[model samples]
Target chain A: MLKFTEDHEWVRVEGEIGTVGISDYAQEQLGDVVFVELPDIGKTIAKGDEAAVVESVKAASEVYAPVEGEVTQVNEALNDNPGLINSDAQGDGWFLKIKVTDASQLEALMDEAAYKAYVEGLG
Target chain B: MSQDHDVQDLKRTPLHGLHLSLGGKMVPFAGYDMPVQYPSGILKEHLHTRDAAGLFDVSHMGQAALVGPDVAAALETLVPGDIQALGHGRMRYTQLTNEAGGILDDLMVTKLADDRLWLVVNAACKVNDFALIEGALDGRASLERAEDRALLALQGPKAADVLSRLAPDAATLPFMTMAELDVAGTPALVSRSGYTGEDGYEISVAADDAEDLAKLLLAQDAVAPIGLGARDSLRLEAGLCLYGHDIDEATTPVEAALVWSISKRRRAEGGFPGAETIQRQLADGPQRRRVGIRPDGKAPAREGTPIMKDGQAIGTVTSGGFGPTVSGPVAMGYVETAHAAADTEIDLEVRGKALPGRTAKLPFVPQRYYRG
Candidate 1:
């Protein structure tokens, strides 16, 4: 199941590993992600940590980690086609796959309904 | 109790709701509700203008008129430009200078009639400009605030062809010329002028007719409503200066590299404010100058990035971003005049790291202005 962090990154967990990217709402705000500077593979990150830098034409933003884990893979294709994140943020735009260091971190994420409500409240 | 009521408070244009519906990330800009970009994104929007056409809602800019028995003389006293020499139906770009030779604001001035001068100024600086102009005129001329006016710019390569259908005469108005016309049956003032380096036109109409004008323009196959995001990139690509970021009161026209706006007559006569100081700078050359900077790598150096020479901080980046046309990072900054020459090696302090950069000629992307 997909879960969302307050920072707007989305994660889909399976066993002790998960794929992470930004929510559609976050991608829409960033406006045409031109470049994505990814975290190196095998790098460790804590929950809510700034994982990568995403630059748009007008401004730059930091994409944060949803849960503590070791980066196993990064979407290298994003270097050439960052617009993939703007077009299909939740699926193909996944930034990286992580090997969860602690499974309990997933429990802190919000479910779909909670995230939907949270985003609505933002408006 | 409505969140939108807050948006309405800060001057909403006709397309405010449309921007929200398009999922435009709304932000406050120049005391107005504006869309920085839509879902297709800023980069795409930026590239779209370079590739096709981008419609810009620039209604936030202040539109006023200096009307008097001797409007040209009154305007001349405030700005250094030779207002009298500007032929009727033509516009000139110039700066309002302070006594210290500092730029109060850079603006566009047009001779609409024998006794009227049309003025467009920075939205944020309009109030101050009005007061300053009024004070400078000292009742010699009257400043008429055209608050009921709306301004829109259709910019890009296809702009002229797209706008020609509205007023066939617009197609012939040569750059810097303005004329009254009926666009889509609504009376408007169309000018062959724009901030984008691309060939484009700016239309001024009654505020009440803005929605109809915008819809009619958008209905054309070549038009797309651009937001503030593309505006910044387009202007940057043109090597145009943004008021607060690139040119400010602290910087003179010479330092900002806008000495070209000073007319030969004004340069010789020296009757305008800051005449002595500006003349001195014009003759001796400025100590620091604005120049284009191209980073050696893909990392973009943005505003406030410290410029370095020999590993020491020398100046700062004014505006920087990814140039879609160049397919690389480009920037503009102020460096010591010695280092301002093209091909000079420099460094930009980006993200706490010194990135290799080179001084280069401006308009990193060649400007495609249609002078003919």
Candidate 2:
């Protein structure tokens, strides 16, 4: 199951863990990702905490954790090729995986169809 | 209502339609709707400008002329640059200083003729600058504001070949020189100068003809429309100062490392505003000095980032970002003169972490200005 936040972060729930990354619309707004700072593994983050940073050619933005969890792993490929977010924001661009401590918080987020409608409303 | 007011306040350039047609991502810049990037993105546009030619709008920048029998001498009262020595068709880059030795704005002055001088200033500073000059001149020189003219910059190595195809005389124009000529049937004041360190030309044409002229130029094989994003990166890599960031009302020419712009004759004569303070700084030394900085990592140290030297705050970065040409993070800021030398060890505090860096010499990329 995939859940989205109003801040444009998306998480894919797989069993007790979830893969997190920014949405395609968010990547489009931040043109040409230049660098990314990943959160350390074993770090416990609260919901909506700044878990990582994404730097584009123009400015930098914080990628927040959509739900509380312990960071189990961070994407190492992003260290050398941060543009993966611009190229593949959904799959290969996954920022990190966290062991969801509060899976109930995921229910507060929007689904794919709801997220699409929400983005359109932003226009 | 405020959002509506903000949109209503935005001024559009003559090339606005062209930018939209070319898929430009327009954003507010200095109260104008300007493109920050195109579909090609900033990295590609920056590299394209360095490798070939790039066309920039720049129509929002302020342009005006000063007319009087003794224009140069009269204008010299506000700036520290030597105006009396400028020959016909020559230009000088100088700053307008306040009475306290702080910079009001940086501008380019061109000696068009004995009785007339052309002025190009930053867009954001133009309104206040024109008013300041009008009040200070007090009939000594008349300010002829050109709110109707549009400016365009064609920059890079292939800029000459692309422009010469329209005006053959452009090929022989010397650096820092301006001439009134007919470009592709449109009359223009073309200067062989630009913010980018590349050999280029800045053309001042009638606002009504800007679109047609830009289209004509972009039709060339080597020319592509560049946005403010790449223009910023190009100037950053070139180590040129952006008015408000690298210099402002709080920074002086000496502190900004722009003493070279203050001519030797003016330094001795000392007739301009803030002359007393500037002269003192020139004789002694500035408290701090501006220098180029290259972080040893991929993280960029942006504006307001603290510069640390041995756990103590030494300075702050004013302008910084990823330099496409340098292939890494590049920044510039003022530091204690002791730690301002090239290759001086330093640390930049980005996101509360101290990043190792060094004070590098200016112009992270070698300047390729075509003197001939």
Candidate 3:
């Protein structure tokens, strides 16, 4: 199931793990992504904690962790090609994968349909 | 209610409507509702300006005329430039200094005909700047604010080619020279200089006819409407000092690495405000000096980021961001004189981590001014 956070990060869950990346809307607002600072593997973080940083030509923004977990993997490819976030923000640009410690935390996030409506509301 | 009032209080330039029509992303800049970027975004707009021509609406800046027989002599007391020696049609870049040798603002002063001096000051400091100038030169010269005028800049390599088609006489004006001419049938005071380190012109025209003149310039194939976002990046790549950012009332000209703007005659006479301190700094060097910083990594080191030397805080970044032309991040800041040398290794503290950087020469990209 795909879930979304108000901070513009989206996550896809499978059993006990979740993959995360910023939404297309977020990428568009950020303009061109020049650099991505990822969290280290095995770093435990709480929900809403800053997990990564995305730098654009003009500014930098922090990417928050949608749910509490330990970072198991990060998109190493982003170090060389940060523009992947601008090109495929939802899929190939996934920032990290975390070992989901509490699956119940996902229940509070917005589903795909609700996330779409939320984005529209912002307009 | 206060937020709404704040929004309403923002001043709009003559090209406000045109900016909206062109999809400009308007933002509050120095108390004015100005376009930060258009639909093309900052990166593309920056790249486009370097390759072609970028038309900028700079009407928010303050323009004034000092009229008196001794206007130049009176003006010299407030600034450190050789205003009295400025020939007709010649403009000089100068700074308004305080008693402590600190810069209050940077401005352009042009010698016009008939004992008249034209001044263009930064938008953010205009109010205070005018007050200082008026208060200082009240008896010797009279200051007349030209609020009814609009200022526009056509910058880039193709600026002269596009502008020459409208005003043939503008082509004859060399860099740092100004002339009165009819541009597209509208009377204007044009200067062959700009904030962007490119061959360009800054045209001062009447407010009512600004849109018409802008449209005429935009009609040229090489000209495009550029907003403040690209304007900033372009100036940064050119290593131009932004008044409030790179320099302020707390910064001295010598400390900011702008000694070149201080003429040899002015330096020797030593009559301008803070001349004593400036002369001393000129002779002995300031404790801290402005230098360019190039981070090794892709992440930009923004303003307020601490500059570290051997695990100790040495300085802080004042203006830093990605340089589109250089295809990397570039920055400028004041650092201890010991670390101000080019290629000196340093670290910029970004987001709780130290990123390796080096002190590089100014103008991350080489300047291409049209001297002729």
Q: Write the per-residue lDDT of candidate 1 for residues B15-105, one digit (tens) a residue.
A: 6666687677677888888888776666777788887888888888989999898999788887888899989999999999988788889
- CA RMSD per model (angstroms): 2.7, 1.6, 2.1
Docking class of 3: acceptable
lDDT of 3 by residue, A2-29 (tens): 9999889999999888999999989877
Q: Ten residues in a row with the worst lDDT in model 1 chain B?
A: B1-10
- The C-alpha stretches of model 2 lying farther than 4 A from their native spots are B1-5
Best by DockQ: 2
- Model 3 C-alpha lDDT per residue in residues B1-372, reported as the tens digit of each score: 001336588999999999999998778888999988887888888988899999999999999998888899889999998898899989999999999999999999999965899999999999999999989888888889999999999999899889989999888789999999999899999999998888899999999999999999999999999989889889998999998889998999999999998889999998888999999999999999999999998889998899999999999999999888998899999999988999999999999899999999988888888867
User: What order do you get sorting by TM-score, best first?
Assistant: 2, 3, 1
Lowest-sum lDDT 10-residue window in model 2 chain B: B1-10
lDDT of 3 at B66: 89
* Candidate 1 residue runs with Cα over 4 Å from true position: B1-5, B14-25
Interface RMSD of each: 4.7, 4.0, 4.4
Error of 2 at B226 (Å): 0.9
Collision count for each candidate, in order: 0, 0, 0
